[model samples]
Target: MNALMLAVALATHATPVSLEDARARSRDNVQALTAALQASSAEQDVRASRSSLLPQVRFSAGASLNYIGPQRSYNVVPVEGGGFQQLQIDTPEVRYPFFNLGVTVSQLLYDRAVWARLEQSGAQLEALRGEATEQQDTSELEGINRFYSLFRTQATIQVLEANVRRSEQQLERARALFQAGRVGKAEELSALVNLGNDRIAVVSRQSQLATDQARLSTWLAMPGAEAVEAVDPGVLTQAPAPAPSLEQALQEARTRRPLLVALRQRLRVAELQESIANAGYLPRFSLDAGYQRTGPEPSVFFGQPARQNRVNGGLSISWDLFNGFSTQAQARRAEYQSRVAELNLQQSERELEGSVRQSLVALQAQIVSAELAEANRKAAADALVLAEERFNAGVSSTLEVRDAQLKLTQAELTLLENRINVEIARFTLMRAMGTLAPGEAK
Candidate 1:
């Protein structure tokens, strides 16, 4: 039996993970990965846009065959004395094969629109980078929340199991008293009922622990079939640090928040779009040069006498004199979009401020609640000891002891919950302030 119990313990044991470790393992989170991919794509777009500013070189080669149908020609032959004789001649089919190779290079001398597009692409890249950071922050926060949740459930289950053991002890005591004729069978039955209820509560708590463990494991990208255990960071015994002033928090959020930075970048992009749209009002200039070789044969080998070589260079200018008022419409649309981006930025700022304030309040409240719960737990423990003593001395009934045990269980669970909440609230405030990072508390 001892060996069987040891085997069960070993089988059920889970490896403990910390919040930081869990977050490190969560790099493959879908949202974060998606954001990273988008950022990479935007980086490619920036490269493409910048390439447009450089000279473009192209090489082309082609071979073609031409054929014409048989032709009839009339020739007038001068006779010996006068132009009186006409002669008919037949011509063979005309067929030829031609080959050409060319190299061309073009450079844009002036185009405000192309420059604006490059600037826009650069701004877009910055925006995507900010979004990627925001996604990472979000994923880290989620991992922290799950980690604490699992910790809380595990602690609660411990308390529940202790309560079940206390109930069992109370039932045994009641049976002893009834056999000694010091208490009635009713008291024993009540104790038995309490034990059953406590056991039921334990079962429920264990189920909850299982569920929370699964959730945390999934968030950490661990195998779904494996169990994950959380190690208590002992926040319950330590005092929470005071929260920063609301003004300071708001400043930090504005300065460091990834989403806000992204919005600002997007606003720049929109402004650049407006410039690009208006660039159409000006003319564009470019220089192009080309070299070509043409021959009747498909070979360009060293200086074939039949090959023809040509070189050309030119400056080109394009001006859109009219485009059915499309440029005007585009400029107007860009302006509206710029306005929209500004409004979105402002709204996000307001929302972020609100979140920071709310998190601060919650953190303060949880800290105070944790303090009170600690005191309550201590008092309940003393009460339980006294009740047990009175029951053993025959001065109090088993009911009093059971009630004390229940109160102590509640107190312990409450303290555990409040401590977990304090930690979570602290991290939440950090997230809202945009300072959340792996393994580090703001």
Candidate 2:
């Protein structure tokens, strides 16, 4: 109740919104924003992987204190030619501080594994982007659905309110007739009961409208105190175009569907992973070089700067040869995953075909339903007018007029619902074909 009051207060000063505005508001939606952020993170992964293919350089420096113990030696020279004198020598203890600095650079001369990993990262990034697009599309479609629902519910509430007013008028007329002895009390009572029923229907419809508005608020990312008033949008009255052939739709879905594209990229990533694992069986070559200075203090090699100054470089090869069959197992697992990706891609394609077909069929059915509902509404309106006239002429009772009004109210509501359904179905078809987006249909 509090939320409803707050919404009503906020809505009082708000302008009505259209379907396009609803779709645009979805750009700020939490789901869409989160997906976009994830895509950006994936792009960074691509950059990091590319960096691995470049040369690496690092610097190191260290300092330490050392202690040296005394050294003692004793020697006897073969008895010193039969007059051997034993000689003993002892060296004093010493301590020194040592510091050194070095820089090392390494570059990959040949490594198929690193190259494959770079490719795999690129494929994974592509898949992430596709998934992000799918999230965006899904969020937009949900917003559209909620907007239409709120609009339809609001319209129904208006119809119920109008019905209640008509019932009240009929009750007044019945009361006048009973007082004049032209009608009995039962007729007036029946009219009063109907007015009560219409009032109850109005209350029920108002509750439903409130619920629908709350749901739309969430999709629009509005605060609880803010309410959205979705106007007619004008799309409800527009007729849908003819659906494309089934085979054409299937082809388009296979090519355009985000999930299918993402899965295909995943399959490529898995294949690259397999290549990377197999690369372990081959020798890797690299070039590494370093410069070092050793002295009493930290210094690079300059003239008379250090006791030892050295520049070293080497070209090295590494071969795992055998490592407990780990490489073989990894390759096997990647192969299995590759198969899984392939199956996933195929499954998405099949489902897309089915979804597209089903939506098209449903769209046609809704179009027909809307036409029939419009016709029914017109017929009910004519009957209501004729029954009202007959009652006024004393040729019919209030019951006939009441039944006609009820039928007309129900028919009007049905027409509104059917129109909204047709629009929803058309959008659903577009979504299934991977073409649903803001401003596209409009």
- Stretches off by above 4 angstroms in model 2 are 1-17, 65-95, 175-185, 297-307, 438-442
Report the lDDT tens digits of candidate 2 across residue range 1-442: 4444643554475546688888777655999889888888988888888787788999998878888899898877557357776689898998887877799999998889988988998899888877877787788788889989989887887788789888988899888888888788998999999998887776666667667777888788887455668978775466656667788777767767777777889999999999999998999999999998777644433346646778999999999989999999999999999999888888887788889999989988988888899899999999999998887666788899899999999998998898888888877887787776533210
TM-score of 2: 0.87
The lowest-lDDT stretch of 10 consecutive residues in candidate 1 is: 2-11
Point to the candidate with the largest TM-score: 1
lDDT of 2 at 98: 84
Displacement of residue 415 (Cα, Å) in model 2 is 1.1
Highest lDDT among the candidates is held by which one?
1
lDDT of each: 0.86, 0.82
As for candidate 2, its clashing pairs are 79-84
Model 2 shows how many backbone clashes?
A: 1
Please report the TM-score between candidate 1 and the true structure: 0.90
